[model samples]
Target: MAKFFQKNKTIHDENKLEIVSDKSPFAYVEAYKTLRTNMNFLSRNSQYKKLLLTSSIPGEGKSSVSINLARVLAENGKRVLLIDCDMRKPMLHRYLRAQRFRSRGLSTVLSGNSTLEESIATFSDLQFDLMTAGPIPPNPTELLASAEMGNLLELLETRYDYIICDTPPVSLVTDAAILSEYCDGVLLVVRQKYATFQQVKRAKQNLQNVHAQILGCVLNQYDVSKNVRESAGSAYYHYQYGDTKLASDGMMQ
Candidate 1:
């Protein structure tokens, strides 16, 4: 059984937590701390409960962020549920290697054919739960925007401390924008060196148009390598923090 995340945990920087490996237990601890700090900031605006993790486009590591964020929340003595709301391209289940579960998950619940409780798969520790995108529906946007989706989220609000939805990229599909309406907050993940300014602007606009609480953007896969080019096509990735020069993309802002 997986152990539950305790409160006030801390981890060192540079420790990466792998979903499939039992190694890096300390990395998990550290990852939990980093995510918990982010969660604290997120809670300031939308409460610490329901959140949607989306990106401007696909293959941007948003699913990875969602998985780790939920695990961190679970570690903090909060019952966390990570829902794979990206019906078109469900990756949360694959990343978590979540066993003891079946497919036909959120799609079923959203279509009113099943209940949220029936689809939720509890982890070994009971602190972390997972709900996969069961069958891919033809019209994911319609299902996500329906009243049943709202009802399911409302039910989760009363039970879990955190409900994280891993939805499709906003620029790739309307699924994220649709699901964001039911969530309290939306965290957009923008990959460094990949996502364009136009796509990000459109994504932010899409969420804002729906009145979704934009919790701020997360710059994933941040690299400080001297050889790497900046998102704006600059060769230099250094920033002057006080007198010391820091080699990081300005995405941290």
Candidate 2:
């Protein structure tokens, strides 16, 4: 398991979203570099490459995290494929600016309306392939849990070194927990001031109930200045692995 904190100040602009790249802020880039290193260590130790990222609720930034994580991994020369598994609310295309292929993606492939190769969109700028959520489906849960979805993943694993799936919030629906069965690990994204402690706890419990391998949690949109002001002394956060206790404030101890 791996645990890390990321603080991003970039505001989401629907017309032009920002992702990690050479032109990004130094601190933002370095944070994702650290995340990449941590995930690499976990991958080597656990022998898993398929990772699923979900949050306790909407607006937690899991999709953005997934996109940047895949971008960083691809920057390291790995063959990465980022999939938009949130069929009900697909936004990867919009984030990556590949909305042109929004109509033909994972849903179309799983439903036999399109082939995987035909649905995949390649972003030359990002250097990784993307499979959008496709057109919104009536039964997203069923489509994700279908045998075809499993087979598609199996085929993709053979082609790519890493597969990052962005799923819906765990607390809002069972989609994340259900898709966890096909993934090797799960990363929970928690927005600092937005998501409640109880909501996070319930999300973790939901994944655990499905026996999902929780790689770790990412604290998103963390405000370093606010924490420094509140603590009056320390500006750093800490986390402990295995047997770690969750403090009442929802921090790992």
Best by TM-score: 2
> Against the hidden reference, what TM-scores do the models get?
0.75, 0.83
Count residue pairs with overlapping backbones in model 1.
4
For candidate 2, the per-residue lDDT at 253 reads 8
Any runs in candidate 1 off by more than 4 Å, and if so which? 1-17, 20-22, 25-32, 44-48, 225-253
lDDT of 1 by residue, 188-236 (tens): 9877877789989999999998898887787765665677534321111
- Per-residue lDDT tens digits for candidate 2, residues 1-253, read 0111223323244423446755565666766788899989987888678899998877666776787789889989988999999887677776555667787899999999988778887666567888989998999999989998888999999998899999988987899999999999999988788779999999999999999999988877655655442311111212222354221122110
Going through the candidates in the order shown, the clash numbers are 4, 0
Residue 40 deviation, candidate 2, in Å? Answer: 0.7
- Give candidate 1's error at residue 115 in angstroms: 3.2
TM accuracy, model 1: 0.75
